[model samples]
Target: MPDDCRNIYKTCRKAAGLTQEAAAERLGISVESLRAYETGQRVPPNEVVELMVILYNAQHLAFQHLRETNALYSSVVPEVRPRSVLEASAKLTNRIFLFAESHADRRLLRITEDNVIDASERAEFNAIMEDLQEIVEAALELRCARESS
Candidate 1:
């Protein structure tokens, strides 16, 4: 698959132990259509992607497709690089440790104590939020990897 294809649609199909013709038939799509999506020649609709996710038993594919296709999601969501369950668990543990060591909980409490983020606290608040997002992303990735397993 081309690197620019964004999501590994084809790879996921193959990983599910299916050939092009077989997967296409299961997806209820023409082989040419599936090929187009895999080759980056066309973007598969959300429904088709959803079908692929279920048919392939790959939850990560749904998240990857969303991240790649939705501009707002792409901007705000952390990129979830595919990794083994072990790798994802380690990443989550590291993120949690870093967050805890940084006293983000205290900072967050202080920042929101007044139910508002004053200008002075905006940067710190953003950093905490980003850290939290990383933790969530790691957990989600782990779930996806476990599902595939």
Candidate 2:
């Protein structure tokens, strides 16, 4: 996926080699509706987005859709960059290795050993959470890569 694209919906549709009419027809929506979505004049519903995901064979778009539409979801869901399956797998493995080297498991255990996150441990706890999120993002990317294949 090109990072410069203004809209994932538009980008994916183009990547799928779909004209607006064809994509709209396949998605069971009108061309105007799809144009509205692509132009960001309206948010596509989850179901329509799901259809696009299947039609485009682009799973990452689902997450990107949610993140783009919902503020809370956007805060929680990591932005998964599109990559080849091999790249995704390598990224996931690298994340796991980095997490292990950080000894986050031991740190987490200590932080929760007393069922409380002490002020001193807060920074480390947050850092560990970030590492965990990176792992999750990589996993999602791998899944997306497989679907795209």
| Candidate number with greatest lDDT | 2
The residue pairs in collision within model 2 are none
Give the range where candidate 1 is weakest over 10 consecutive residues by summed lDDT: 1-10
Q: List, in order, the clash count of every candidate structure.
A: 0, 0
Per-residue lDDT of candidate 1, residues 65-123 (tens digit): 88888989878777776789899889999999999999999999999999999899999
Q: Given candidate 1, what's the lDDT at residue 66?
A: 82
TM-score to native of every candidate shown? 0.90, 0.92
lDDT of 2 by residue, 6-30 (tens): 3789989999999999999999999
Give RMSD (Å) of candidate 2 vs. truth.
2.5
Please identify model 1 stretches exceeding 4 Å from their true place: 1-3
